[model samples]
Target: MVIISTENYEKIVEFCSKFKGLTIHCERQLHKKFSDIDSQVLSAILSKEWQKHIKQRHHIILKSSRIYLQEYKAQARLKGDPFILLQIAIRENFSPVSLCRILLSVEFEGKPKSVTNEMIRNPHQIPDPLLAANVLNCLLNDKSDGPITDLKRQTIGEDYEIRLKKLASDAGLNFHDEVYLRRKGYDKTPDLKLAVPCMFRGKIINWIESKASFGDMASHQQYIKDQLLSYGNRFGSGIIIYWFGYLDQIGRCPENKDCIIVTDDFPKKDELVLINNPFGPLLSSNISNITNLL
Candidate 1:
C-alpha cells in the first residue's frame, strides 16, 4: 500500500476547496464518442485545448493523477460505467481541481453535463483529520493496480522470477527464465518459462507472470487482454502469480482455463519444508484445483 504525507494531504485539501462546482463526463457517453471519432484526431484536439485550459486555470497538474487517468479509462470500459470508477476518487477526497483538470484534459465529445445541484448541492469537504486521513489513504492506495514506475515494476518482477527459480530448483524441476517463443522467425518472450514434464500429471506449464501488487479484477482483465491472451495463443497454458493473494477469494478465472495462483497461499519455509516431489500433497493440495485446468 502507498502512503501519503501530511503535507501532501494538506495540499490536496487546499486544492479541492477552490472548486465550487465540478463537471463530469459519463463513461457510456465517452465510449460512444470514441466509437464515432478517430482516436488520433480526438487525442490531438483534446491535448491542444487542454494545455491552454490548464495554463489559464493557474493550477499545476498532479503527475500521479494524470497517470491514474490512463488506467482509469480502461477500468471504466470494463465496468461499463465511468462515473462509478470516478466515484472511487471522489469518495477518496480527490482534489476537485485535479479531477476536473484530468477530465478536461481528455474532453470527450457530446459535452456531457455535470450532475445537477439537487444531487450535490455543495462541494465535497474534508472536515477532520481522521476524515482527511481516510481520503488520503484512498487516493494513494485504492485502485493502485498499475505500477508507479516501469523500473520499479521491472525490479519487482525480476525478484519474483528469482524466487520462483529457487522454488523450482528445490523441487528438482527445471526453471527457464525469460524464454521466448519463436514462430516464423519472430521471437516473443515471457517472463519465466518452466517445463515440468514429470510433475503434476505431466503438465507442460510454459509461462509464469509475476505481479507485485494486488491483482484486482480490472488490472487482471487488462493483463489477460494485453499479455496473457497472446501467451495462451502461442503456448497452450501458463500460470500467473499474484504475490499478495488479492485474487485468492476472487475464485477461479472465469474467462480462461489457465491457472491463477497466489504466492501467499503456499506454506512458508518456517511452516513446512518444500520437498523434491513437484506434486507433493502439500503443494498439490493448494494448486491442484487451478492447475487441473492446465
Candidate 2:
C-alpha cells in the first residue's frame, strides 16, 4: 500500500477544501514543497478519500430508499457502492460515459477545484481533484470515458481481443467474436461467448471475459462483482483471461467453481498458466484448451 505523511495528507485536505470545485495542480504543489511525496502516495490518499465519499453516499442512498441493511450490504459486496448501482437499479437511461460526467458535474457542483491559469499553462502539472475524480469514476464505472484509457493506452489489454483472436486461430478453435449473452428478460450481458467443439461433445458454449490489467485482489474483486459472477451465473461456466498475470503478488488464482483464470507473462513471453480449475495445465504455442475448459 502507498503511505502518505500525515502532514501532507492534512495539507492536501485543507487546500482542497478551500476551493472545493477548483482543479489544483497537486503534483506541482507536492514537487514544490513536499518533494518526498510520490505519485503512488497521492493516488492512494485520493482513492481512500474517494472510497469514503462513496460509502457516505451509499448510506445516504440507503436511508432515502429505505433499503434494509442486509440487502444493502449484500448488494454492495457484489456490485460496489450502492449509490452508483442505484442509478442502474432504477433503470436510468444513461450510458456509463454520460453517467460519469453527470455524477462529477453534480457531485462537484459544476465547478472545478482550485485550478489556476499558470497550472493550466503548464502541461506537466497534474490537477488533484480532477485526476482523483476521474480515477475514482473510472474505477466504479468501467464503461466511463476517463484517464485510464490514456494511462493504459495499448499496454493495458487494449489489444487483448486481438491477441485472443490470434491465440484461438493458432489453436485451430472455432469461435465467434464480440458475442453478447443475456437472459430473455434480463438486461445484463457478458462480453464474449465461445462455442467449444471439444468440450461437452461440441455442445458447450463458454463465456469469456478479458481483463487487461495485472489482476490484483482488488481488481479481481471488482471484476468478480461487475462481470465474472454475473456471467458465471447466467452461463454456468466461463474463462477469465488476465493477460498480465492474475494477482500481482501471487501467481495463483482465486478458487472458483465456475470460472478458470488464465495468466500470461507478457514480458518474458513464457507459457500461459491456467489456474482455479480442475486441470493444472500449461499452455504453450498450442492454445487449444482455451476452447476446452477442462
Please give the range of 10 consecutive residues that has the lowest summed lDDT in model 2: 265-274
TM-score of structure candidate 1: 0.39
Stretches off by above 4 angstroms in model 1 are: 1-154, 179-188, 196-198, 201-204, 248-250, 258-294
Task: Write model 2 residue lDDT over 60-164, tens digit each, in one string.
Answer: 443434233344346555755525433442233222333333333333453663332222223134344433333344334432123443345445444777777
**Candidate 1 residue-wise lDDT, 1-294, digit = tens:** 122233532332343334222212222233344454333222222322333344554343445555555555565556545243345455534433345334434433233344211111212333333323333333343221112223455786677777876765665555456644343343555565554322232334556677655454546677777777777777556566665433333335576555433233222434332324553565565454335433
Give each prediction's root-mean-square deviation over alpha carbons. 18.4, 15.6
lDDT by candidate, in order shown: 0.43, 0.43
Q: TM-score, each model?
A: 0.39, 0.38
